[model samples]
Target: MTTEAKICQGPHTGGQGPSSLDELVARVAACGARPRIALAACAEAHALGALLDAMERGIAQPLLVGDMDQTARIAAELGRDISGIAAVHAPDPREAVQCAVDMVRRGEADVLMKGLVNTDVLLRRVLNRATGLPPKGVLSHVAVFELPASGGTTRLAMMTDAAVNIRPNLQRKLEIVHNAVAVARALGIARPRVAMLAATEKVILPAMPATLDAQIVARMAEQGEFGEADVAGPMALDIALSPDAAARKGVDHPVAGCADILVAPDIESGNILYKSLTILARADMASTMAGSSAPLVVTSRGDSERSKFCSIALAGYLALAARS
Candidate 1:
């Protein structure tokens, strides 16, 4: 299990962040405690495979919530058993989501995961103030990617509001950046470099509203609005990721090429970039909704079991960090 040596958060603390599935599994084990996960719609066999793996690794103690028949059926098909696993009977998928959220609110679980349920159904349950787990801040998805580095090492980078917040305004972007900063801190990145991404590195308020938004956010960051992060704005992706390109373009900024967090201009760009990395660049990703009191693992239906497992581990890590 190879762990990426991440720049740890805070002035005195330093440690590594998980760079692979195996490494994340190990990090969760090193916590010496398992996060209780309320897994809604556990009937999905592929998701169950991931839950089973996390349980085997001692990172997750899941309360399987959904149609028991489906769960049992999938478990049997996989030649597995939920003998030690506790389950709640929620025949209706929507009701299953409520059941899972209630479990989290009741302190029976520290994390929530979406399984076979629809995204809207699951998110509605999380947003419902009466029965659902309302978030501490605005809900947004932050995806952490592990790209190949020198000596075959992996570098952990993050992109925010990718799966949520379409066409965010300046205020919404502030929340998004704050959420991403939390993820960076959880990954042990003290003062993570943040790049406010746009088409060009120059700001043209009328023609490019995104650059203006980026400029405002960068100024807010300069004023210590987002604590402990080096924020720079209106940077092209090339300048944000490639040091050589930054040098060639004479973009003299601390976060120009060494950015760990990228604030995309819009959800369209964010989602496209996320899928491109996952599918085209072959980058491994673990994503979840940030700003929730307890971590919420939300993977797409098309995501692989490895992705699900990684998401669970990431949520568990977030849970542990929150507790600390």
Candidate 2:
């Protein structure tokens, strides 16, 4: 059986994600691939650094779209050599996004990454039905996290639509879950445990829209909508993550204390959860835009190079999966 199949069927259900970014990188290496990535507006240090690292590690082959001269200068400043890195000059940031997006559409690139360009501009191309990257479902942000081992197993946690979907309704949430589950499957989690996050565990009608929606979504999962994944919902953040909290609250769920995916209530709560983990909890995260035919690496300015590289690795793994 493949790793994913084993994950879904393996007797050990002690919840394991990757222990470190090293594991993700190792998975990419196992694919024996260097995914071609078209990075738009490649003028920022963070983005370029990430690309350089990925290239060095042989995880990605980058096609830089930006001012070639400026990108070369920045590379020199960063103490890196881009003598062999393929690049194109778009003369402007927006046009650079166009160039990168066009590369993906042309099959010259397996992945599209955002560099120095504004997110709105990059997204305009990504969401453009005529020219944008096509997602498998709805475009949603899937941020992967490698949590510390809680019992000799490193748990991988994923949060969805943290930076993309705004106020996702029931249908949109379903799409978001599918999108995230696709990502989880890419990461070798066959039957990922999904927890639909809400304010509380109560399924009060009309009073808690999120809870009600989550309840229905869990039922849909029970109906085998999300493959072999275990889906639970109408639970608070703490109840979803902390077994101790779940027990204190008398909540016993297979997904509780071991959720692979956390379906946020909305973008507000999703963003807050994502930021809290990164900024305060000192978590390492890899975020990418999924639901497309191609994976898009998206990161924050405040993100570390490791995070950005993780995003690249995430995209690489997904791209490899699609090809396979």
Candidate 3:
């Protein structure tokens, strides 16, 4: 049977959403459709390895746009066969990125993955007004983390704008929240709880600008601006995740302790928190650019093969969900 035929035969539950990365992959496996991924400048070993793994697991169908000889060499070095995969030769990195972006814009690909090219190069092509993927308002990065809880369990949490939109203003933050909530909903969180992070839980004028923005966002949430999502702001990091800390701090809000999403005040704090969770706490994460025409996988070069594969799974699932 053909790959598409086999995928169409997979079972569909349309039931509970995934709570962990493993479950997320399983959900994608059960989606009965494979998202077509276009990898820009796909000469990198780690990125190719992850895409190969994803293809083997039926999570993605990859279209490689790069130096085909280098891709074949890397695949051979990794002892993986790429005979069945499609390739578009664009030896120049910029050309490769533009080709990949054009594929997405033309609906030839469902997802976009960054490969050997620099991020700015890839993003510049993607943000090109005429030949790029048009933004749904603004482009932002959302990192989904599977963190270890108190017991021997793990929970999924999302952090936003860690890699994009440095120093976003109030309006931009609102757009970021909307982008994140869309991702959370795509992941099956019916009503995500959002925590706007700040140094303290108090809005001190002239000192903490983040607190002011957070307070305004929280009020907007109360006014039904963010749809079904629950949002709170001016929450310290400890109060955002720890119920015990919330209790001790006397923070009586719906999203104080159990926030499904954390919105950072700036890129520095967001990137630090994201890296801390990955490097210090040893959390597993999958990240993608939200608010794009299609799901975009932009994992860091320092990220593991597992991280890249999981990112493909996340993006694949989102692509399938968007189709549904």
Candidate 4:
């Protein structure tokens, strides 16, 4: 049987209203994979909770690396059973990050999960030239969501270099968009509509280079330079997310009304927009590192329990699909 046929054999439980993160994880587990996951700095309470949930549901076999004593204490506080988990003793966050990277590099784990480490510390090891799991290259974060308003079908939005690339130029932006489009394809989105967000709809004179770059990239897509996506950009945030805003501004573009991927011009805008959506709008999120040899889940400590679990589910599904 084909991979899509296998994936479709599962019950249609997603893309409905108020989809559960656990249910997403369960469906991924049903896809004939129980990925071995490596957790770095596994002493944080929330991270431990997510790992515990994944373990209990048989979605992942976690090889946890951190301060063993601290891990035990945190696990006890969370009432998590670590009886069968493999705990590697790395007392510091940097060391734990190295251990996690080495696990994946050695073919012992399929995915990497971050815990209580500093983001830079974890990234330094992962992007280290000599010992990283994947080669040191462009790493971007794309957070996916299954919003109730959109029904059960999953929606993907990406903020380039949000957690990695600080100030990307036009070339880096192309790489970022390509990474996000790969994620869209992995989620079964055919010809995903991409909106390159700008401060305004029009490419104003001498205001921002991003708007000009957006127009250029959209034309690139039209010319078949970029593959498998309809890319339009230099759109305002309001128009990108709201059809009414687009209609009022007389923006006649397919992505303006119904964009599947919203691409921010830079890291600050993307980070601010993502945090605002989560903190203010109560949007659920599942984030992973893209443009790597494997899917990486580095969920924030401030994330909701549901978000953490959903990220694990997303990583699991990507790992399964890679094998498929």
The lDDT leader among the candidates is 3
Q: Lowest lDDT 10-mer window, candidate 2?
A: 5-14
Evaluate all candidate structures by whole-model CA lDDT and list the values in order.
0.83, 0.83, 0.87, 0.76
Model 3 local distance difference test score:
0.87
lDDT of 1 by residue, 1-324 (tens): 002112212111246566554676677776656788988988987778888888988888889999999899899999998977999989899988888888888778889998898888888878877777777668899988785666888778898868789899999899889989988887778788999999998898698999999999999999999888889998999999888999999999999878899889888999898888888987778889987767898877767677788889889878776655
- Candidate 3 vs candidate 4: the lDDT winner is 3
**Alpha carbon lDDT at 138, candidate 4:** 74
Descending-TM-score candidate ranking: 3, 1, 2, 4
Is 1 or 3 the stronger prediction by TM-score? 3
Candidate 2 segments whose C-alpha is farther than 4 A from its true place: 1-19
Query: Which residue pairs clash within candidate 4?
Result: 15-152, 15-153, 16-152
* Model 1 vs. true fold: TM: 0.92
Candidate 2: tens digits of C-alpha lDDT, residues 1-324: 133323222111233434566787776765555788998999888899998899888788889999888888999999999988898987699899998999998888988998888888898888888888866568898999877667776667899878889999899999999999887876767788999999888898887899999999999999999879899989888887888898898888899977889999899999999989898998889998878878899877888878999899888777766765
In each prediction, how many residue pairs overlap at the backbone (N, C-alpha, C within less than 3 A)?
0, 6, 0, 3
Candidate 4 residue lDDT tens string, 1-324: 234435542223222311344455666767555777899998888888897898777777788999989889988888877978888999988888998999887777888899888877887788876788553347888877644435555444544445677777888777788888777666666677888888987787687888998888888889876576788878888887778888998988888767767888888988887888788878877888897777899988678888898888778767665655
